[model samples]
Target: MTQVPTGETVTAAEFRLFKTRSFSRHFNRTLHISVYEIHRDHSNRQPELTLLDHESIQAGDEGWLVFDVTAASNHWLLNAKYNAGLRLYVENDEGQSIDPSLAGILGRRAPRSKQPFMVTFFQANRNQIRSTRAVKQLKKRQQKKHSDLPHPNKLPGVFDHVHVPDGRQVCKRHELYVSFRDLGWLDWVIAPQGYSAFYCEGECSFPLDSCMNATNHAILQSLVHLMKPESVPKACCAPTKLSATSVLYYDNNNNVILKKHRNMVVKSCGCH
Candidate 1:
């Protein structure tokens, strides 16, 4: 018989470890949990098999252990030469949280079902703009035929039908356009005058008067200009140059009218 250590004796069969890896080879994953208990001799001289926290398994760098029925037989006697009770938990690569579910699964209870959750994940890549070169080609073609652009007046007065969030009345149509200022990418056109609604397709929504307006329409145009047909939202079924005016305006007494006239002059002169 093998002599047990003074403080504890652990057999190889009581615990198991398993490992997984990231797709990019960036990280390694592992799981460790305890399986079963062992009885000691009638003298009770042996130490109990105290299962460490699940985090211990997660500490494995490359390989992990999975405790199966066969693995459970490998036991270490605590203090004495007999089998002992094993308690187990789970940990991740960081060995941070104690994963109880992982322990339960190892103990043979029904494993938790894996379900996909709905959340948007954003990844920033330096090459993202370069990857969108195809979109740029499409925009050039559209810009050359600017005369064919649809006039906003031709569209139905859908703005009247739009219900403002509050009892606010329809002020004026604020034209939203997409322009690439200093930024290499096209950004949403924000008006100095507040926006109450967005005129897209034939429907309109209210409360654009808030600080954070829906730039989705302008974003749709940029996407279309970039010829990224796939990125276009379904709500943006209107023509590329469709002019839907937002019915919201800021009233700084006479200052608003003077600003509007100044804008008209700038528009006529083709000034930026």
Candidate 2:
């Protein structure tokens, strides 16, 4: 319920208990803990709260106990204020003990460094590529006229925006060496001064074949576009395969540490 990733569904939530905490000799060294969600009153009073999930867990050698509060965490991610409270309970056949810390999620004012935290995991993949078959087919009236000439302003970076030299008409992978020093990134990147991060180039013409790595959907889409050129865009030349690049970067905080940024290389090209 604390400082979790928003927008994305929380896949898992972990609540940890650190340092000296004991249930009693009744349950030996183990404790049965149930985590619950607290919902605020829509009328702005205390709306309500409900039980999400629970588990019985034992402490480790380090006296650490981690409980999965994912069910509650996901609900909060939807409408955070909807589930506005936290209740931890210890239940046994003898009786159930409830600890209401209406204090709630990360937004609540809790003691610094002492507040119970939720370590949430999210399926966070920010980079998204449009599939080859994802071209939009527009209506004739909605289409507008455009020139075949290229844009006057040009810049170089990666993937589709790369420049294709004259005579290279077929879509294919091209060698492109990225120089960290030229970009003033050599201070962090300590390994090779540069690497050949290939980029895709050229055109996706009619009858897009396997040579261009065009799927059947792309082939049909291209054929449809020829009859109505203003309604759809042609397929783009872009990377279909990508591989990570290992770089030595220093995180010097007194001691030096090396880290790898695995997102800057493309391994293959395709019309997509």
Candidate 3:
């Protein structure tokens, strides 16, 4: 078994020896080995090695293995390489070991470009009542409403919304309305009513309902559209009035207490 330095190029014989001897137990398995290199252009650099499925390699193939390296290194490459290793591990399949030089062999492979960020244009009625206090009060009410809602068993709650055009058709008070059902419950609730329009950009996950905002809502909506239908609610609407309240309740010692006391209810549920 040969021990190659991190940044150094791995030779064919060295890789074979490492595979057949030091890593013999991983013969029919996958090994996640990091390849480090100092490239003048990071974009052009390739992963030092990749585990090739046995099906892709011929029975007696002993030469260098090749792979079509994707141009982008951000997400696709990361996820592909990760899942490739996982597949190798879980399936316990024989595979060809590719050296970094294979990147040059598979030249001019079709470059995988990133999907463009979806741009949405909608008429947003800029609140004529730009009182910061009013906005803050509304925000506080929204927060209270969210806080009062039942907690979901899942970390993130997924929902769907109809993309409506802004104009006389929509109300002025709210920006968007999302309809979502709580976990273990079938009833769907309309959230933060009386909004103009909702733009769903991509998928997102969050722990708390109060955390749902324009950015996250868009992401969650996107994810719901992409992955799981059950995660998303049947529909969403724009509400007219903020259903949350912001009032500080304090004990004699001046300790702030949240108004909706779920802990007390849980303790008294008598489920023991």
lDDT of 2 by residue, 176-255 (tens): 99998999988876777888888888777643534576644555565455333457776788888887777776665533
Prediction-by-prediction clash tally: 25, 3, 16
- TM-score each candidate: 0.18, 0.37, 0.16
Cα lDDT tens digits for candidate 1, 132-171: 2110111111111122432211111101122332343323
Angstrom error of the Cα, residue 91, model 1: value is 1.4
Q: Report how far residue 82 has shifted in candidate 3, in Å.
A: 25
Task: Please tell me which model should have the higher TM-score, number 2 or number 3.
Answer: 2
Off by over 4 Å in 2: 1-168, 252-255
Evaluate all candidate structures by whole-model CA lDDT and list the values in order: 0.29, 0.51, 0.25
TM-score between model 3 and native: 0.16
List where candidate 1 sits over 4 angstroms from the true fold.
1-82, 102-106, 111-272
Q: Which has the higher lDDT value, candidate number 1 or candidate number 3?
A: 1
